[model samples]
Target: MTDFVDNVAFIGLGAMGYAMAKNIRKKMAPTGTLYVFDVFGRVCEKFRDEFKSFGPIVIVESPKEAAAMSQTIISIVPGAKEVRDVYLNNNSGVIVAPKNEDRLIMECSTIDSQSSREVGQALGTAGTGKYIDTPVSTRMQGGVPGADSGTLSFLIGHSKPSDTDPISHRLEKVATMMGNPKKFFYCGKLGAGLAAKISNNYLSCSILLAVAEAMAIGIRSGVDEKLLHEVIQNSTGQNFMADVVQPVPGVVPDAPSSNNYRLGFKTQMMIKDLGLGVDAGYATGIKPTMAEAAYRVYENAAVDPKCIDRDGSSVYLHITTTQEDHQE
Candidate 1:
């Protein structure tokens, strides 16, 4: 077909995974063959249709089927549990499949550091593949453009390292070819990238929660919402949360808050990442005091029907509105 990348496959059709695979097929044209598998058959079929113009797309039944067809695989799933199931599960997982070859496995999911290492270790033990975690972050409020336009950032670490190595270079090459080369940060060691991502997200959720609280206080205290944001954004209080998330809708233009929090990172996903950080804290004997507080707030919000399918930034609105409801 276009160009045969029979060696490359993607193992998930989650929002980001689907979009990245679709765009990579179009732009990179991986051997006119980009094998794909998803737990959802409909998503796989839909992607198979949409991706045909760029390459030969296969809708496989299991992770093993996808692995059999490609020498390089990229997995972008929801979290650690799914990651474990897809690559390590004995029944039909990739590593346990018969006749598997040495492949490059790049994990782009936002999984915990522990899981990353565990998966990497398993691959090593099984002699199945070279594993690397290049967990990425982006404002996925938009669609494929978020990945295609080079807006996503990749944080990477490999299970093995050497000055002159085969695997990491290939991992870097494919990532650079498929994504924005400039956005990648190659952290050392297999689990370093995941640790970095957890810390980064911990700060993100923590600050977003604080921004929500501060914005609610400002609005209730008679400070003009727009004016208060303008002042704070230009002052020492500014962060991505206030500057971008803008918990108060009218304060920022084109923000998720302004759009009813649709099409942005989901509120529950934020709590899930926070949970990973909290788990790390317990493992390391360090208390993630602020993260625990942020976790509690988002945990409470995640269960609220009001926050369902809402953007993570909606946590600010949830806190403010709940407080007002209690006071009333």
Candidate 2:
């Protein structure tokens, strides 16, 4: 174990985090240590075995251990509750770690803006670290593949929005370790990252449902599925979901639709994120008509056994089979 200057820590070894951490470890200096933590011990072990050759990968027991030892901490957990647990759970959370002003904490989950603010406030008061919300996104429906390929975009919410701020430069330097440099957006103050993300997802999920419904109508009207999709792709109706992540099977050969709608963002999680957008809309006194409608469809689809654990686009299958549609 050689002494290194840029020791960094990453938490959450789930689908997105695993790939993000893998890229971080691969891009890290040979001597720098990459500390990782996850609630599942097996995931940590697997990550170490798989990526240790890229750099020194240290598997720690808790967020405290990871934060205590690293100059920068990046986390992308499941949801708000898990986010609070990893950062606020007194005994083991990162909040209890030694106070280190130089330590920069970046959370990359697409949780509610409120939770991001809560953790940011707690970190500020505790003086453990500086907290920034950095929720991940990508062009089109590039989910896991975006993380794996290191082309993902990050929405950053830092205290200093100025491009010349030393802290902002530092944020980008570390963020580009797992994201595209040109694709980074410093979306304003803390909580703004999630605000941007929730808004993006609100539109993305709505488009997903719209695409699903349009495809259903076309197919039911005797238009060939792939042909209808191709027409839409070349016509005015095309969008990312239509061209890149077509929900219709055989339209996109490698999409989740072709793979039984598995290994993508789950329908239940889509509902949760949509609900976040809907709640934000109400809180801001703006009616999110399309988001609310999409939310209802996803909520009902999530309860169906066939679509519950499938990809969010599985709503296509649900709509075609269930005979329920949202309309004028």
Candidate 3:
């Protein structure tokens, strides 16, 4: 691979984006220039000030400016539409056509495979820059400590194997700066990363829903929620959900689930991802009953003010509370 580039531009400074950008600033030593842009002026200014001590923090007006100023452009926008608007929409005057063939564009949004392919095609045809779909699997909290430790797992979709090597190496450095770089898989093709992210998240959401249902049943049957969680933890269900955060209340006392579900992964975001998963499944004519059901539950919860304030783990509270309130 070629020598790692120093200057980088980051678009979208949302919770996760801000953390990733901050980690990049910390790890890329000699302190390379970092240009950032977001719809919120305050976020841009905040990050600019926070990272100013580390290196040069340029606050730009738009995505195009950020793309134009750096050798590599990274996007961590919310959804497929935002990703398209920031990178591919020519009408917005924010499309950053690459200055040379060496430039790289990495998108870390969790969207669908189709959207990823379309965006990748457009960016690739722009001729100067190569695009890579590198959606992350870690949670928002993971962003803070995860960035510095380089423990975030990345599933990458690249135009070609050769085009990916340098970007992967650079991202590993960036990931480790944030936390510990665990797994970086080159999944192949332009949309593979998006597909992998959605598939993984669908399972996560499903498991959380299952855990919520199980806990609700146990609580209704006079079984303690903590005991049920312990059994599940010792069982095969002890994946990320059991180890990191449980969806049921009283399972993990320190988890967001026990704290009324405030500030983790928002229910609105989970609903959006479930929608994407449903759409993907429908397109393939595969029945995703569990995923579709979970999507509806999150969708219903998103409208509730309490659930809206909490993370996806709050689904357990919704199930348990509703069941208790409705019980005879």
Number of the top lDDT candidate: 2
Model 1: per-residue lDDT, tens digit, 1-328?
Answer: 1112446779888878877786667755545578888888899899888778777787788888777777788889887899999988898888776544358888898888988999988987887777888888755322334665545678888543355785666676677655666767778888899888888888888998999898888888999999999889889998877887787777788888888876578888888889888888888899999899999899889988778788888887678779989999
**lDDT tens digits, residue span 45-120, model 3:** 9898887888788888777777667778788888888998987777542355545556677888888889888877
lDDT, candidate 3, at 85: 91
Error of 2 at 247 (Å): 1.3
TM-score of each: 0.92, 0.91, 0.89
Candidate with top TM-score is 1
Ranking of predictions according to TM-score: 1, 2, 3
> RMSD, each candidate, Å?
2.8, 3.1, 2.9
> Which regions of candidate 3 fall more than 4 Å away from where they truly are?
1-4, 91-98, 140-150, 159-168, 236-239
Candidate 2: lDDT of 187? 79
Q: Which portions of model 2 show Cα errors greater than 4 Å?
A: 1-5, 138-141, 159-164, 324-328
Question: Could you tell me the lDDT of residue 190 within candidate 2?
Answer: 92
List pairs with backbone clashes in candidate 2. Answer: none
> Candidate 2 on 1-328: residue-level lDDT in tens?
2222368899998899999999889888878899999989999999999988887899898999998898889999989999999999999999999997667888999898988999999988999888999999844424688899888888888654456665566677777777787877777789999999899999889999999999999998999998998899889998887886688888898778888886578888888888999999998999999998998999888998878878888989888887844442
Superposed Cα deviation of residue 92, candidate 1 (Å) = 0.8
Residue 236 in candidate 3, Cα distance off native in Å: 5.4
